[model samples]
Target: MSFIQSLKSSLKASLGSKQRQVSAVPQIAAKASENPDLEKLLVIPVSDDPKEEQQRSHAFNKGQFLARQERWEDLSKIVNDEDQNRRASGGGMPIAELLCQGARADVVALAEHLLIDGTPEEARPLSEAISALEQILGEHSNNHVIATIVAMAHLDIAWAWRGTDAVRDTPARNLEAFELHCTRACQVLDPFCGIELDSPLVTSARCALLVGTPNAQTRVADDYEDLIDLAPEQQRHIRALGHHMLPQWFGSYETLELEARRTAARTQDIWGAGAYTWTYFDAVLVDPYCARYIDIPFFLEGIRDILERSEDQHNANLFASFAAVSIPNAAHLCADDLESCSALEQIQTAAQWIMSDYLHELHPLIWGHAMEGFDNHARIASIDALFKQGREKANQVFVRIFGEQMRKGNALIFTPQGLYVQQA
Candidate 1:
């Protein structure tokens, strides 16, 4: 049987009486079978009409191109126009692309105006954009794009407060607007599955509580606990190194404690699964820092451990994002001078070393995306240069770990089942 058919059979056996009722699996499998990248998996549904979807897709593509080109003003105009049309038609396209580029102040301003003044249909795109921008900013704390977006969020919030009489009449309206922005920020910055104590959202809620809102107090507590437990110790350690390396650069003790509590609450043990079947993944993104300090030995050891545990050989693929830096030097530098080399260069060198050492074993699974210091690398390098200075960089490295069973035609969605293997 095909992978999907096999998966369906397995799922049916696992679910027993409830198997007949589940319908999403087939649709998911079909989507994955058609597109190898799982692009549909990240899409947020906007409308059912084919024409609207096409227009929105075109607009999104244009917006992305404009962003890459640094043509912020033109990008803003196109998105605003598409958003307006979407409002008039009562349907729209996904706003992810627009939000991804809306880190510009003018873009955010235009989007905000459309959201507040346009039809009810505009609400969804606005909210999605707000949420996405907030999330991106939170994750890359020191990114200029993030700072710009946060500034815009604040500006829009201020404008809302000033433009309305709700501050005096219906305080809840103003509070809701502010809360949405903060919540988006929190969601973005918190680890994909971990609790976050330093989230601006949590902090804002606390402030609001001191000023009144008894219900928010309970929500704040619940959110805190949920964020903490999203990931356990090993995942946190592995992921944390991606943020910063030096112990001194890490967040304070209280922050770490809160995170630990939240993490403990969210973690689930999957060790009971006998031998995990292998599945291939399309990509594995890695932060430069992770490639630098943790990935090498950790990955090697992991491979060895998996082999020893399973006894039978299983193969999986890997993808990594890194910079290619060429330095002209003989082995004549002192230890302190070597340490002073650009962190980006060090990360690149380490990645090269790791790739070289594991080339024979990992060649099939390993593919590299070079960042000529223009894309994410530049932003991360800039962050490291400005704030931490060899401490930590404000950039994320995406890593996709494939299962041995995953095939080119197999559908892979970011659902609970896929996430289990992805996280592993």
Candidate 2:
């Protein structure tokens, strides 16, 4: 039997409850036959028809969509084909000229794909992506999306080369380049209302470039305060991200947790699974350096309370519980065996264990999506049935089926657009 099927069988045997009529559930299984990297969650859907002049702008969006999905190979193929086609038609396409979303998708795809791969050959493509983005910005300096994307590309290039032999030769120069991109992005984004703390562009850039800098704690906290008016879900995401980012810049754990409590209190959704905040929260706990300051069990107990009070709970709660149960022991394991205990390895192992033991009794569809290497779903059931089974088992299921998913390689890519963005 499949994982969930087996779990149901066990439940019937143990509880002696009559067989409940099972129903179909919305399956969150990603593309089964493909590697997780090619999967996407399209966030900003584009119109099918576009004016000739609108094509270039649309191309950028399409590229971003592909990039978010992490479809690197497809993106590369499309970019190459478009470049060849454009050359055959008329080789003199100006960088400043806006292409339809179709054309822009090629350039955006190249830039983002290079960001995740981190190959030495990526240098040329990174430069090309920036140049194209710059051209777009030159003509449309006020365009926040273009400016933000340009900044993201710059940061990605910098991240791709960090600690590399080439960049190590003059690290300061490389950092300066990143700062320049940030400055450029902020020039366009800062003038817009609610972009500083709210924009993915600004928040992500700050986390990447500014996190380790001096006095980042104060600035990040201030940003949180400004974001209070946003919906609780957004606030939780930003705050949780802040929790992860602040400590690197010397933010106090006590202070950070205090803020987190306040944010938690504001949320009507007790489990806080509405966003990917739990991932960030779990990430903090997994850090050995971070564990010294946190009261692991205490922190988890609070989460447990949220889960208990949560109206509609799911696998996220179980994932959180699994982390709470497994992380401390995992940390000890890592401390004992440094070779095996890399942060990514810790998360991967935790996920595997959760699949095998905790949610292992549940459906592959319920927690299979939660596991790292496993993608193919064995079955699907009703959302209500999943919840019912989850309640019976004192577990729940969650759908983190979209938004930016980071792979084990430490490469981050945004998923394709969906009704629910995970805010990763």
* Best-matching candidate per lDDT: 2
Question: After TM-score superposition, what is the CA distance of residue 297 in candidate 1 from its true location, in Å?
Answer: 1.9
Whole-model lDDT, model 2 = 0.39
Candidate 2: 10-residue stretch with minimal lDDT: 88-97
Q: Please give the TM-score that candidate 2 achieves against the real structure.
A: 0.46
lDDT, residue 385, model 1 = 30
Model 1: CA > 4 A from native: 1-152, 155-296, 299-424
Candidate 1 accuracy as TM-score: 0.25
lDDT of 1 by residue, 74-156 (tens): 54455444322322111211242234333343334334444344444444544444454455455556443344335435444
TM-score per prediction, in order, is: 0.25, 0.46
Instruction: Give the whole-model CA lDDT for all candidates, comma-separated.
Output: 0.31, 0.39
RMSD in Å for candidate 2, one decimal?
19.9
